[model samples]
Target: MCLNSLLFFRCLDALVHFKHLTSLIADHNPITENCFLPPLPKLDLLWLNHCKISSLFPWVSKLKESCPNLQHLCLMGNPAAPSYFNGGTFYEYLQYRLFVISQFPSLNHLDDRKVTEDQRAEAQRLYKRPFFERIIKPGSGSFSQLVHSSVTWSGFQNKLTTLLGKDKPNDRNLMI
Candidate 1:
């Protein structure tokens, strides 16, 4: 069913009772992560391309639990376009960095193209380190603790540069 262009209506709580919904095209709506509070067990195709979605990490991460049968997803025009995360196009960034295939193992078609087994395997291998560092082996300190740690300003900048692969100017020194 298509529910596109509904400006004010963001929540889908009322649709939770539709247990057998197989396809949902809710594009051009103001939907966010809160819209899918309850799972849509039978949903197979979901088109949520152009909306106010800002971060795919948290939103799409819950797709497996929210829509177990989802095979096709179109998140093309969202603010969290994969290109913004890296210097490549959305598809390339999605394939290498975010590991979209790994995140949604059940997804067969993303933005209309079929996902190949080889591509899935490559994504898993390429993003293994990032996945482990971000999710599995997060830094030991709590948020505040890490923020207030005694590490020098330059040290922090160096670490950030290393992680993000950005260059730091050699002429300037940051003091805390």
Candidate 2:
């Protein structure tokens, strides 16, 4: 924190020790939305994967002006929220100025790495198309990766049309 010596305190019952804070990793939890790591001047590594977060990646970017020694930051596996996914279903590189990278200039490692094939497939099967599309068309690519050529895609769509039951998504009703 900007404060020189506030001793230590807790926020919303989240344990935070400011004096020796260095590495913090709290992934796959809902509490991160309310937790704040006040510009930990000594922090070096931060991991925030799958907090169900809708906003901010490597959020420590906000601490660029203060944490000059930080070396690693990770913010991966955020959901389909607009702020998390941008325009693509997959995570891509950030286009904006990396404030933290600029600050720590030495900060060369970001651990928000990519996913595996099985991971991607599992994700697609869970989120994108309804269950029927998957069962009827089975994705053209490996079950884990969903990439269909035009021909296969059309076939998959047709299969979906034929199999869509009374509970199909509203968009399916207007498909040409």
User: Which candidate achieves the best lDDT against the true structure?
Assistant: 1
Cα deviation of 88 in candidate 2 (Å)?
Answer: 2.7
What is the number of backbone collisions in each predicted candidate, taken in the order shown? 0, 1
The Cα error of candidate 2 at residue 87, in Å, is: 7.4
Query: Model 2, 1-176: lDDT tens per residue?
Result: 56635433223233344646788776665534435555567877766666655544444344453456667766565542223454532222321113223334545465453333444444343334545445444544464454342347766667666655334654232110
Candidate 2: give the clashing pairs: 121-144
lDDT of 1 at 93: 51
TM-score of candidate 2 on Cα atoms, chains taken together: 0.41
Show model 1 residue runs off by greater than 4 Å.
Answer: 1-8, 83-92, 95-98, 127-176
Span of ten consecutive residues with least summed lDDT in model 2? 90-99
> Cα RMSD for candidate 1?
7.5
Which pairs of residues collide in model 1? none
lDDT of each: 0.64, 0.47
- The estimated TM-scores of all candidates read 0.62, 0.41
lDDT of 1 by residue, 1-176 (tens): 45543345587777778888899887888887656646888898988877777665566657667787778978766665455533446454554333566667778888757888887786565554542243212666555665576767787666666554456454322110
